[model samples]
Target: MMLMAAVLQAAVVQPAPGMLVERRLAEAIPLAVGDTVRVRALAGSAQPRPFVVAGVFEREADPNRIARNDYEVRLHLPDLEALLPTHDRVDRFAIVLAPGARADPAARWIESVAFGTRAYGSAALAEETSATFRVVSRFHDAIGIVTILASAIFLLCVMVIRVDERKRDMGTLRLIGVSRGTVFRAVVLEAIGIAVVGSVAGAGLGVVVTRIVNAHYARVYDTTLRFALVTPRIVLIAALLGLALGTIAGVLAAWRLVRVAPQKLGER
Candidate 1:
């Protein structure tokens, strides 16, 4: 009753026999205002009945909703009553309270008055439904941690190989009275530059992959919901992590090269 009251508040319908089609249904059937369409209940032996398209309505957008859009249509109370064998009973409905009203207490009150009804706050319903999405997020976090470890190891190995190649040059600089501190700073800066370049390339590759994956899944699933999200913050954080790993790798590589005696650098 309360739900119906809310809908009736904004609904300006004539006493004529017609039904409102959801935007998705309207577009799918190529229906226009005043077009007549046959509707039938999914269950029972009810035969199809013709109804004029009174209006079209788009469902409110919910970005976080994982479910696909519903092609629901609404009819007037009396029309619905004739179509459904519901017998003046509604199976489910939601209630909106006044502003600043307490949900827990209102839910309790509603349950008390409405026997055989279970009323829970919207927060509870949202949490219950979003549980799977939360699990997927944790899985992504685990993969990220493993990726970071692998990246650190690979960066270290590359830096060690690079420093080994430059051993002769480092030894020559040391012989020319170049201080170890200046030599260390040079190697560190080179590593940082490599990291910056790699990070930018990786970000670009990620964007391309995201587009491909999203487009492929959209075709497969026939849904408009996004399967992945890549934000600027995520990219920035990855770049910073790369820089930190580069700095650490540079320090270790520089230390290995500088600790060797300048005269012995020519030896394998």
Candidate 2:
């Protein structure tokens, strides 16, 4: 399942021409300036209240406004207050710190005036988000481990079968006075070549698939949560891992073939 908390945190908000509507929402409902939109004042309200679309904005003014749904709309403070049941009370407030200003004193002052009010910094939000997705992160790690192990096992099986089929060729090399180490090196290099090709192809396909999936997610959720990111470091790691697996499998197969007498291998 896609993690919603991460998506909400990464969403970008920017200044808009007028009142802002999410990009996806604007596309779905085609609103223009001076147009009127109805919103439900309260649950089970018989009639929806109409508000003028002063402007339709795609960007957000505040980053803290966590909107998970695509059908989101923003309005001016006064207009929003006018629709609420209690004009005096607000759900939350955000304060921006100026340069050279301290946060502790301001937080203390705000708490003293308003009971039950809590102040948090950007770091707190990051900590909370990480905690929320800890399990998901662990699951992803487990999947990576399983994939590596499966790849190693599959390569081992294929190399073993290939060595069996080429027994006569190995015997011929041995009869021609080729050193065991040289024969083993040749087999390992061949396996590495095949593995490198396959790994590179797989990585390319993975990158394309990841981009398509991420685009679909943005279109559907209107959020910027990337499912997969293929970076240079990731590519390097994959390539190294593929080479290691191939080397291990090839060594095992070559060892088994070399242990048998050349005369016996030739007879088989």
Candidate 3:
């Protein structure tokens, strides 16, 4: 929970660079340290002077966890004061409280003293955002469960059909002295192969699709909304699910084969 701030001191005082910019802003403008950047003033405002790029900072953790405006820029007090129509007016101020201090009482006191002041609690905002994420996560989980179940059912059906088609071949092998255990193992191995290949391909395709979507959103909205994150844990889960599905399908197919006698199968 490191807090970052940009401070402006006397012009004579030398600081690390001049102004600090967020990583995302730097990327958008492609600015480097020592580069001079000029910002155009909004309507009815005087023109802004150029400021040197001091440093670029990035959010150490996920941006969603922090309450910040990525597009906001911080400048030295002197620099900002020079740009403002008024010499010493500020839009807002940030106050950091000591650890374990209650913010409500302080906020109330501040509001009472200041006219038209609004106090917002960061904790409340964080809690609300977390709740929203939880709901969305549950929806995604429900969709994933439905998808997996549907895939399992489809795989089971396909394997059953494939086994039926191979009944004559299986009967010929059994007639030639192939053991039931060997036939079962062969069918199970084939199912496992198909599942493994399908799982790898599917996972790869998902990663590519997610990357593309994220890229599009970044370009359009200037935000990083990675709906799908490909990690080791995710890969492991996908692999395990695939193996489980394959095992279940293989067992069902083998069980059906065992129910029919080899002689009967050959007759059909």
Q: Give the alpha-carbon lDDT of every model.
A: 0.82, 0.77, 0.79
Cα displacement (Å) at residue 69, model 2: 1.7
Q: Compare candidates 2 and 3 on TM-score and give the better one.
A: 2
Write the candidate numbers in order of decreasing TM-score.
Answer: 1, 2, 3
Candidate 1 C-alpha lDDT tens digits along 25-100: 7877799999988877776677787899989986654545436545678887777777775676787779999999
Q: Write the per-residue lDDT of candidate 3 for residues 1-268, one digit (tens) a residue.
A: 1222233335446643267787787887788878888764463388856778878876444547434544656777877776667776566677889999999999998789778886668777567658767888899999999999998998888889999999999998998999999999888888888789889998999899889887885666555555458887988899999999998999899889967899877665
| Clashing pairs in model 2, backbone N/Cα/C closer than 3 A | 13-60, 14-60
The lDDT, on a scale of 0 to 1, for candidate 3 is 0.79
Q: How do all models score by TM-score? A: 0.80, 0.76, 0.63
**Once superposed on the true structure, which residue ranges of model 3 sit more than 4 Å away at CA?**
1-70, 76-128, 223-227
Best by lDDT: 1
User: Which model is ahead, 1 or 3, in terms of lDDT?
Assistant: 1
lDDT score, candidate 1: 0.82
Q: What's the CA error at residue 114 for candidate 2, in Å?
A: 2.6
Task: Give the runs in model 1 whose Cα sits over 4 Å from its true position.
Answer: 1-16, 22-24, 56-70, 76-78
